[model samples]
Target: MTDQSKHEVQFFTLHGKRRAYVKAGEGPVLLLLHGLACDHRTWLPVIDELAKKYTVIAPDLLGHGVSDKPRADYTLGGYANGMRDLLTVLGIDKVTVVGHSFGGGVAMQFAYQFPERTQRMMLVATGGLGPEVTPLIKFIQAPGWFPAMGVLTLPGIRHVETLALRSAAAYGGGPLRKYTRDLAEVADILESWKDRRTRFAIRHLVRAVIDWRGQIVTMSDRAYLTEAIPMAVVWGREDQVIPVRHASNAAALAPELRVEVMADSGHFPHKDHPEQFARILDDFIVTTEPATYNRARFRRMLRSGMARADTTLASVDTALTTA
Candidate 1:
């Protein structure tokens, strides 16, 4: 069991709504963004260790944790703007933005929208890289699923559901063992849905990015922008939620991207191996130079459209040859 006492939850009001977060340690700022349906607590596994070397600011993004769930914008752009406003109010000028799953999409948007404020970006099993996603996410976008979820989480029913999930995640072996970690994360998400507001926020948020087929939004159109930012991709080789192959999609877009696949881990690689995750992240920060954005170059990339396929492939080949 995690020692929750180590994390002191704090609150701040933004645009009249109370937002909850945990801020700890001090040094270069690290803005940790949690995935959809999760709160700041999801980072508990590595936050303390990370905080020892850097100032870590992990917020329950607007609608998720103890933050207010209003009829507000949940789009990626809105989330990026929210991060900017939050950092501005806190007097944090820049950050090494780190995001997980949906939070990864937010990290990319934050970097794109405010490159000057983002020194580097780290994506962990993030979305917007490709169209493939677990069927469960797609199912949530299905019509009537919200109300059905409501029924599933009703009073006594939720207890049984939670127990079943935990049992299966813990003891269900054979083929199911591969997805045990993913199942555990799903159980946590379901537990949060007991709150009506959380369910509403999750529904709206899911619909915004996912569809019946799979993910509707993608970063491929703007992937060339990675040239201006120091970025890294980390994915669990066994990740069932977002396929680990998406890491290659990111590498294909920008060959400079450092892709680390954690074997035997699922969607939550950090959770599966917190020590290794922290070590990898710390090494990345120590080795890579933070991005320095130039307005002229930014304008040039925008005007040039996506980098030519041949040029991008050549760069990939060159990076491989050099490695």
Candidate 2:
């Protein structure tokens, strides 16, 4: 792995708003998207390694990270449009998108909305596969959740809360070990929430996709579109937030999906197993051909949509192993 500290975040302005991102290395483009409440830093683990061979562009999504967070669109489709515009401004034509968690939903939407610009897709512990999600996410939808966050971020209280979470994250053994990283991540998220604007933005973003019943949006309906785009889905076997089972759902919907479940990893596979994650990603890009968009074929699929709906999901690979 290369020295992550050496990678500096660059900024760009779009629509009069400033956005922060990290661009490194050179070659074919690889657009890395981080999960909710996380910024481009989440990709630091594998960014340098991947950057060695590919031009890696990891952006802090509009509402997350240091990006300007105003009263702007935060829906999945809105996010997809934002990515397309960003790519346009950067003068990039096509890319193999890599998205984690909420970013995964945006990746799928990006491909769906602008297939011509998408070369391939790589999803990590992605959302929008199913309605099942962790209670922690659902709890955000609960009334007073925003107010509660405000209280938690109070000066003295914030320090104590972050300290407790960090302590739990440092525990070396027993069941807590399995969730130590998650605890640490939660602490980081809490720290970020100390900024009132970020808290407000996150609230709107979460409400747009989640509800009491879990994730309200999904990619299952359009999974058949993968026939025109090569996609690989990576998930941690023990991902408590999204659950590894969701990967099975995705594979079932798109038989062509390359599924890999990392053992002993939770939600953040790239963080827990950076080397393996980078290797798998590099190998996939090397082995699979980038998708070439054909207008006629896309049109036929769109025309045959309802008739072929039931036939979309043909088989299942419930086994949590590399495809």
Candidate 3:
């Protein structure tokens, strides 16, 4: 409702299942992915700016927003596959992927599994690469937590959802006062929250996280950095959730990777600094070579490098123990 003239909400089916997405602008394709407990609306601020120069495709990942939520396994691989199907349905052979938080992990999987199909990737406050997850996230991801949160259905669920959204505004590293006053926005968020499937999908994500530990998937940082795909990483300097240390490791993984640290921002840099985020992405797209982005070779090199790095780290640990 914030003058969304540039965006048109649309829906399409990937493999006979319906999914909803917001399309805006008319230049090159740029797919936007949101984090957990969020839908396409999370990118509203950033999309407003990005639509000016790029054809932005912000989708409600299968179970998130207006999309069909099947009671099936919602692994990270499943999310990546769903994206691949969505792109194929939309006739998008190649695209620039911009992902935030959990979406960042999915974007990495997409690039790793289908590297040639990705033009470039920008990760913002991404997961998977970092070892430090916040205590709040750990609490939410704890087993059997969904049933506890289900108390929202008792009454005044809208009010409860509004409080949750407002609380999340703090996670954005911005003041929560202004966002809480928007009653209509809070109402929409509550409506989305009413979905039972969303809770199930979140639980599935928890299991996936446990499974992903010390395991290589399509979205690992090693894959993103070593892959021939041009990549950049943006982090909120004040990020309490993922922390800036992860950004440092990401840079080490890919020395050539462009890294930007946004001041006074939190996990959601796009929302906190839309103009700056857009400018960084636009510059990367313009300066990077599209043809050199190869998928298979990148995976091979990344895997080899990861093995070597692991051995080196192990040796360092042994030396410290002996000392």
Candidate 4:
């Protein structure tokens, strides 16, 4: 049986709605957060492999997978708090949080909100780091596009999509070929629009972070607060959904961010190189010391020249460690 099949999804009720997730293995806790229009299933490629050494918990955020589609809070902070509640129920406090694309934003929020519980962070082609994003995403979250999406997501549209691609390939020139190829990248995303719940979720949830003009809620300024956490960033060089340059931009903002670029992959590097992704994540977790966040010290850093850390890493006490 495949790793995907081996793990059975368990359900956890939050706010009177069920959130489906897969919980497996034993050891240090590791939470895998999926990107937009995705569920915990996205982690199946690396789940069992990484579960060998760590307790891996991958959840279907409030609206994505088998989880209930309630018109609830789907913002990063909301997602982060939901994760904390899940961890609390399982009696797992500190964890290494790994997020991909949209999940990356949630991971950062998780670290910021509950620093003491965040052991480390790993972002894979994370979103909400910059203003640059796919025109498709920008348009999907646009104001006037909501009503159009209703018609666009009609079940028959998928058949139309296939026919259009075939026609483009058959009769069209270089320009149409390029358009079709680009459309192919997001074809699955488009297919997902057929689901009314998914469409609603994507429309509402994405708008919370993104606007018609790329991403609106950027976390660049908050990078300084992560000085104490060991972080890694993995980006696909060919990521068209979110540019690879955002990885460099994030590295510039965050201190000691270990950025790894997957040359051959596109938007989903973890799926492209699951074994390597798992290896990179395992190495980081095993080698680095987990960070602890003290609320008082966290506040102090904001006040004490955040521009330059005249202060060292802060622990439970006010004492500073010059790491």
Candidate 5:
């Protein structure tokens, strides 16, 4: 275990509300984004390693941790905008954004919207590129489940904490013993879920998923293919949630992108294979240059407008074909 004393956990205001985050080490800025239901603590192990060479900023996305969760639509774009605002407040002009699972979607959106502010990007077990969602996730998305799931708010129930932690481990195929070992932390996360702010965030996220179900298919057809961004993708071959197939599909869509597969790991490859993940990230950062905006590509995208139109038409074709 790394020395906890070496790192500091703090909070800052973004958009007028306080957001909690952990900052460690010193060097080039690296932003770490966690997936659904996970807080900044999920990246603790990796942060311990990366902090040695980089200034790591890991924030609890609104409503998931010690952050302020306001009731609003939690779209990928919304999260990206929040990150942009946070970076602006911190005066971080450029960042190597690392996103996992849902965070990957946020990272991609951020890079697309603010290319000038992003140095590079790394996505792991990300969404927004694939149509394959796991059975468990589908179950979560099932109608009428939201209201009952909201029952997680019943106060003073110690068992709810255990249940939440167990659910997280089971869903991602992580080591159960590690989660169970930290009873206090688990309790904190579960208790946070009961908070009104957190509950609002949860409801917003549920709606966001439903509303953006086909977003990736929609975005892929766009001319963003000229994304000259120095990007890399890492995924566990055994990823059950997003599946490994999407990794190939995403790489196919962006041929210039770099991808690495981690065998025998699950959704959280960074957690399951920290050393290898770190090595791949280190090599990419060392060798890759900052992405330069291509004016011609952007202009073509605007002139054709065919990308967006094609994406919409393709989606219609797919729906009819499937139907």
Candidate 6:
């Protein structure tokens, strides 16, 4: 039997693209999804630990890491369906899906579209919960923004960031300012921007759900729909990107959602507090009951949604016909 915890990158042809992912262990399946402009590397710390008792599969999404970047749909639904196809090919019938940030949106869509295949769903510092997000993320369509960022991603990236930090510190801006200026977030952003395909893909990905103001897409409206799904919402109190308040807001939307706020952590709680994250995940999997997919119940939900849509469409059609 394989150790499951320690593993290397593997490839499988997904949608005619050479997709990269890491698979380990052999038990119940666990699918890990990463955030925007990120890949499977984001969950490096916690993957091994979780793999100890469960089969872990982490993919590089469609365009982010070493995966092929095709000019295609970047919507949550598209990504969700892509994952379903990938898993089907891999012979994974069901999985406990865990997602972080942008990946959280994909996780929810996965449960929504293929409830039968999702054993449970967990969101970490997820997006699509609220309208608010960090200013850093709302960098779309700003005048001169592309040029400025283009310069930053150039060679000597560290020198530029370092000199700026030193200048701030020398000007008596204090260590706090220097530390704030130098964060891993920038490094992560640069990682994707290093390649032209990834850079374009990241922009497309960000634009799909985010705007200059903040996140444009939201799951709050549908959060209540997950009542039948065993769900958990984990966030860092110090999350620098999405607000932790959204966690509570999401719980209110679905009272049954298990909410966990990792104190003394940031946006990347799984990276900052891997042990705690692993334990929380393990507990959730062990304690909560895996959802039983009932086709009748699912059909009812779909009908409910269609009924609402029909009402709106009827109003429009009636008005147009009268006119």
List candidate 3 segments past 4 Å from native.
Answer: 1-6, 157-192, 210-221, 224-227, 291-323
TM-score of each: 0.93, 0.93, 0.81, 0.85, 0.80, 0.85
Full-model lDDT, candidate 5? 0.71
**lDDT of candidate 3 over 1-323, digit per residue (tens):** 12243456689866677788998888889999888667788788878678888888899887777787777657777888888888888888889998888888888888767777888889988876644565655655666567766776445865676667655553533464333333334345455555677767766665566332221232332443544778889988877666666776666556778899998676777777888888888899999976355447665777787776665655433332232
Tell me the TM-score of model 4: 0.85
Clashes of each: 0, 0, 0, 0, 0, 1
Whole-model lDDT, model 3 = 0.70
Candidate 4: residue 131 Cα off by (Å): 0.7
lDDT of 1 at 96: 97
TM-score leader: 2
Clash-forming residue pairs, model 3: none
Q: How do the residues 9-96 of candidate 4 rate in per-residue lDDT, one tens digit apiece?
A: 8997867988888998989999999888877877888998988989999998887877888788888889999999999988897999
Candidate 4 wrong stretches, greater than 4 Å = 1-4, 160-185, 305-323
Residues 1-323, model 6: lDDT tens digits: 00122568888886577888899888999999998877887788888788799999999888788788989788899999989988988998999999999999999999988989999999999987777888877874455556666777677884577456445534533435423432555555664475767766777778888877677776654654687789999998877788888886676567888999988676788977899999999999999999889999877876785665555545433332232
Clash count (model 4, backbone only): 0
Q: Higher lDDT: candidate 2 or 3?
A: 2
Candidate 2 lDDT by residue in tens digits, 217-294: 877667778889999999998788987888888887788889999998988999989999999999899999999999
Error of 5 at 301 (Å): 5.1
Per-residue lDDT for 1-323 in model 1, tens only? Answer: 22363778888898888888899999999999999898888889999899898999999998898899988888999999999988998999989999999999999999999999999999999998877888988887778888998998887998888788788888988777777766766777887888888888888899999987678777776788888888999999989898888888888877788999998789989888999999989998999998988999999988774456445545643433233
Q: What is the C-alpha lDDT of each candidate?
A: 0.86, 0.85, 0.70, 0.79, 0.71, 0.78
Model 1 misplaced regions, further than 4 Å? 1-5, 173-175, 306-323
RMSD per candidate (Å) reads: 4.1, 3.5, 5.0, 6.7, 4.9, 6.7
Under the 3 Å rule for N, CA and C atoms, how many clashes does model 6 have?
A: 1
